[model samples]
Target: MSRTESVDKGHGRIEVRQYRLSTDIDWLRELHPEWKNLGSIVAIDSERLIGDTTT
Candidate 1:
């Protein structure tokens, strides 16, 4: 498990961002050969801090 975080203040809004990923699937390419040489896929999940949200 690994993670990093940051906080940004702008446009009268405060944003706290946390990012995470894994070393849990090193055998990804071996299992899925069709996706040759790909180290990682960018998967992002985002939401509104104060309003509604979506993934």
Candidate 2:
């Protein structure tokens, strides 16, 4: 598993993003053999704050 994060401030807002990746999908491939060439999995999470509100 690997992870990366980034933060940016602009236009009166602060934005944050997190990224994750994994190439350990042997179990998933075994469970779903039909998913040919299955290799890695990725996910991302993001957040933004503007003034006193966050979303």
Candidate 3:
């Protein structure tokens, strides 16, 4: 299942959208070193998140 989530900072700051991946992300490591952290994913679900632009 695919999910989207948003990360919020304080003071109406920049917003971050987060998308949850259902499948194992190990295959993504080759493309994104950040994917290495995929193994730490403990839970995930379908979510959609929206945030403000950072400026």
Candidate 4:
């Protein structure tokens, strides 16, 4: 597993993003063989804050 993150602040707003990756998907490949040569999985998470609101 690996992770990375980024943040940006501008125009009175702040944005944050996170990324994750994993190559331990052998079980997934075994369960679903249709995904040929599947090597890795990735995910992204994000958040934003503007003024007094967060989403």
Worst 10 residues of 2 by lDDT: 30-39
lDDT of 1 by residue, 18-50 (tens): 777665665787799887757564433443353
Write one digit per residue (lDDT tens) for candidate 4, span 1-55: 9999999999999999999999999999999999869999999999999988999
List model 2 lDDT by residue over 1-55, tens digit each. Answer: 9999999999999999999999999998999999769889999999999999999
**Candidate 4 lDDT score at position 23:** 98
TM-score, each model? 0.52, 0.87, 0.28, 0.89
Q: What is candidate 3's lDDT per residue for 1-55, written digit by digit as tens?
A: 5666766666645455656555565666778886666653434333323353333
Instruction: For candidate 1, give the lDDT.
Output: 0.60
The candidates, ranked best first by TM-score, are: 4, 2, 1, 3
What total of clashing residue pairs does each candidate reach? 0, 0, 3, 0
> Candidate 1: where are CA atoms >4 Å away?
26-31, 41-55
lDDT agreement of model 3 with the native: 0.54
Model 3 compared with the native: what TM-score?
0.28
What is the C-alpha local distance difference test score of candidate 4?
A: 0.96
RMSD of model 1 against the true structure: 3.6
RMSD of each: 3.6, 1.0, 8.1, 1.0
| Model 2, C-alpha of 26: deviation from truth (Å) | 1.2
